[model samples]
Target chain A: MSSSSAAPTAKPPMRDALVAAAFRLFLDRGYEQTTVDDIVALAGVGRRSFFRYFPSKEDVVFPDHERCLTDMTAFLAGGEDEEHDPVARVCDAARMVLRMYAENPTFSVQRYRLTRRVPGLRAYELSVVWRYERALAEYLRSRFAGQTDGTLRADVIAAAVVAAHNNALRSWLRSDGEGDAGTLVDHALGHVQRAFGRPADAPVRAVPVRALPDEGDERPEDVVVLVSRRDAPVWRVVQEWEAALGRA
Target chain B: MSSSSAAPTAKPPMRDALVAAAFRLFLDRGYEQTTVDDIVALAGVGRRSFFRYFPSKEDVVFPDHERCLTDMTAFLAGGEDEEHDPVARVCDAARMVLRMYAENPTFSVQRYRLTRRVPGLRAYELSVVWRYERALAEYLRSRFAGQTDGTLRADVIAAAVVAAHNNALRSWLRSDGEGDAGTLVDHALGHVQRAFGRPADAPVRAVPVRALPDEGDERPEDVVVLVSRRDAPVWRVVQEWEAALGRA
Candidate 1:
């Protein structure tokens, strides 16, 4: 490799330089036509440097995914607390993926276009997406372990999160990353959250997700059923609750 | 080249013969070691016959997926009426894939084992799965074209159906294709239906998410009741319960 072109590599990280050079050649020539040797030569780096940054040519086309997937796994694992609604937590995890793309609109849009035309790259991208779905599923499965149809629920919700995020993310990329991706993704993930998230007034709230610190555990007297008269107005019950609690 | 051996090709369909021979060779030898020539020779068929039935060596390992994907697309498209719940329709569409695998349990089990060993085959299987998911998504997009977040909802539900179906299907396959695959897949797909399918008597509510009041979609006597621990701070329960009642 020539030392003349190597000056730029010292400025931008060698990894970024390799990606930049690889994309330049891929766009100029084709993905298949651009060899690793050609990329390293253009980037003024050794073959070892190229391999160090990315395992393969296809990976260069979509860098940062490994890091993003790691971040997503960590984000999902961080939601270990029972109160963090699992479905909503997964939806939020999917949002981190969107942010990865949204953070680099131009590069992501470019990569999206490139990945579409190449069948091998498209398949590779699908595999990467599958890994992300699996991560979310693993997290959800642990959370829903004992529930009826737990594994199915976990897999379905995980796939739903990825699908919703990708649908909106792809739309944004198709438009050249022109719109508000957060709103679009949130709108999409909202469907999954509501469809799978626990009900706000779930009567099985004996161990409510939002239980107060004061309520250590349920006791005999904790079953306070006011059994309001069926005909009683809602406001009257509210008043009785207020009075019974000595808060009136 | 022997006429006596070639006679068998005329007896069995060339496609089935090719698949049977390919798998036998794949197991006896290795997938990479067994080439198209080896399969054709074992099947007592010519290269032309093998190529006519399967597009490539990898295609032989997954002989039924193309036909299954086409059938799935057609099945999804046939659900044209508005009365049909799109989510449930897609779930049924995924069941067609399970039936295809379950129809030939031994072959399905063998293929699943082979696929897990080969990275290329796994990626190919994933691509085939991706096509099935896309078909469902397309049908859903059309069915939910104008509704709020229709595209997002369609995509999410479609992926959920595919994920849930595959989760159960793989579990059955992993068990050496034991037990009833239909029952297992049905249980898994049931999650998708319950999560995303519109209720049979669903009213025209703008948001058809979870109406978690059991059969009572909108009960007039819906009330919130919170029972604090006897020794608990009453103010905490009062405040939190007020917030909960406010939502009700």
Candidate 2:
């Protein structure tokens, strides 16, 4: 048996064939009803070969996610060498996923449809998506370390990035990948950038302060003006105020 | 057999005993090694009674998440009756999960430790958390339906709320729930509220804008002053400008 197996060494093509055969079987027979034997028989491979390529039947549906995740991590690591913004780097990492799906439209669309039908697969996909989000968050956490509200900012921005990326990805999947996925992802990601990203040369606009008309001759002797970025947390403003008061 | 099974009709104590017995068995003999039969035998209950309370052994560890999820959903539903802000409503819903954990500190902390050690349980917990986030996002989607960037706002805010809640919950759990969980949750949630929530009577502060010094004495006849909310989307600002130009 060992001698026989030596001739049919499991190569990349063999793995690809097994994955295609497994997906075909899953689509025809349904994910739950399909057995490992069915997949192996269709691929003309032994059970050992099937296990070598995929740990389980469900693993076949998402064969490339492990590679995709590794590639994303590498992309994020490479970004640290440049003068890139952390949020933009994370968005770029998410775009890698879009490129992967766009590369294989038919398989991606079919997998999306199949996953929507299977609760287990949906949960598995959610977990996978979460790992991607955590990678982004960890990267941002390092970038934002020592700043006030850094951890909260990291987690919130990571979640928002993932949500925005999924919004675009799901929209493309829903359309059967008919439109330009890159454009959809860019549009969706733009919302996050506008909300959180700070451009290097963003202009400061002056907002006019209007005072209420004085009621009769009881005029105020002094007027105190307060200003802050619309999105600044109250705690941060309070901290700034305390620092200034301490200086005084 | 049916008549005999009626003797141990699953009461609250039975469920509690089953959970306690399962956790003890899991600790003594690893989670992978512990069998349903072992749990039933340890608890001195029949297999049918064990299955009646839990669908599987893993379910024993996360016995109350289903109930907590239901309670959270119901709270969100009830909030719609009052004219509550959506972000505040979501934060209150998240507090429900904290209350569940706070109500059973030992079990919650034990489960958290167990889940951190077990990969499968961690994935299950992630899926459960995703469900909670989705429910919050759906509620926000309805509340912000007609506003600009409503869907994006709904998803981002929902994700932020969940992230903030989890940040506080995990901190308390890491400390073994010894401190005031409510105070920690409130402090974490305040970051989100300040970033996204609309206070009942939030003031619109007048920001005094300083004009840039002219490099050359090219005094323009007209000084165009444009003011918009800092957080408004660029497309919205453009639309407002277009509308104003059309009016002019």
Candidate 3:
């Protein structure tokens, strides 16, 4: 076969190298103890190269987040097909994010731990999460434009999706890579889908219809009343409903 | 009245004084350039007293989030009668948080600016937010014990409520304290309420009825099929729906 499968030499990208080095140093020396100098030295890269790859030490820990944000923005922007469904498009976008973490499980795990211990990294991670929610909200706003209260609905949906993803990811990380995280994410997203979508029709219920009073009759049953309290007790509200229905 | 009225000599809480001082210093010297010593000195409180009020410098910049979290937890835990309707209770709990911020608009705005510019304060704020979500999710899990896939639903609901609050709060903050934030929060929570709760019996098209096929009746319309594609073109999907309904 003329050695058709000759070995190919490939080198890690500067960004990836820096990220790997940062993760290692963060784990070995603790996030606060580790400095940019130590990371550049460990990665065998120049200070300028390090700076080019990351704006600061914290940036080294999360190199791909900006790229992921951009990719998610693009995906949401490209979602013009209604057949794909807003819910499905959102799920697919979330899957893209999960796949990004899965692609670098070690780095993600380490980053997760570092974020837990380091306040600065945790804030940075939150900003990244906020960006994700913003992108999702923007996409949803377009999809549900005509619906009443569309902006609020979009914000809620985006937040729910991100929370599901975070919850599933946290569980996977806590288990030390023992579970099927992808499946868990799907299950989580399913919860989100059901929350906003309509439920399947329930079994039909047949009940006898009641006669209404004559329009000119001036009795209490002749007039219907509706009362609502936003913060009233549920049972009290139910009682009010029953009373208003003349069944109390 | 013979001068029987008591004098109005009560000042803002020591904590509030420290927060005001810290905020002023943050504005003047930048958040990073300010120190705990300077804040206590400006607030005219001893270092021990400052520690008694706030555990750390970053703590002074935030509202009493810990107190709010505790109140929320207590409110959620006290849901003896309304345990079945967690959605309502969760909304109420979230409103409590919103009200806390609204009560102190000046401090809230200052803290918001500091959080935006200071990474450490921002992380502390995120941690507080995460705690709120966790408390909400726990309450929801308890309420939805018998339901299938309850945990995920609970988590998503918590996330949605938090997101709505944040969205409304951010809008209020960015607008320089203009507008009715309480009304906005109510509108936001209403979106969440409708998402998980049943819709009102507003008039809508009646669902199509499907009759069961009798034996030996091989009508194509009797056996309905549904095919959904993740990335199908919207027009194609709509056309398929129309075809299935015999509209085209």
Judging by TM-score against the true structure, name the best candidate.
2
Best by lDDT: 1
Candidate 3 local Cα displacement, residue A216, angstroms = 15
* Per-residue alpha-carbon lDDT of candidate 2 for residues B32-63, written as tens digits (9 for 90 to 100): 78899999999999999989888877789888
State the lDDT at B38 in candidate 2.
94
TM-scores for all candidates: the values are: 0.77, 0.81, 0.72
| Candidate 1 docking classification | acceptable
Q: Residue by residue across A11-71, what tens digits does model 1's lDDT show?
A: 3588888999998998899898999999999999999998877899989987877877877
Interface RMSD, all candidates in order, equals: 10.7, 8.1, 15.5
- For each candidate in the order shown, give its overall lDDT on alpha carbons: 0.77, 0.75, 0.70
Candidate 2 lDDT over A1-248, as tens digits, reads: 11212345433788889989989988898999999999889999999998987887778888877777887888787777438888888888888888878878999999999999999899889888889989998888888889887877888888888888888888899999899999988988887775566444422223323345577746432222233343333333333333333343
Q: Score candidate 1 by lDDT.
A: 0.77
Better of 1 and 3 by TM-score: 1
Please provide, for model 1 over B1-248, each residue's C-alpha lDDT reduced to its tens digit, 9 standing for 90 to 100.
11222355433577888888999999999898899999999999899998887888999898877767766777877897887878788888888888889989999999999999999898999999899988998999999989888888888888888888899999999999999999999888876775566644311111112224767557544444445443333334434444554454
lDDT of 3 by residue, A1-248 (tens): 11111323222377678888888888888999988889889989888998876789878777767667777778877886676578667877888788777766776777788888987787788878877877888899899899987777788888899988888888888776566879889888877765554223222221222336577866423222222222222223223333434442
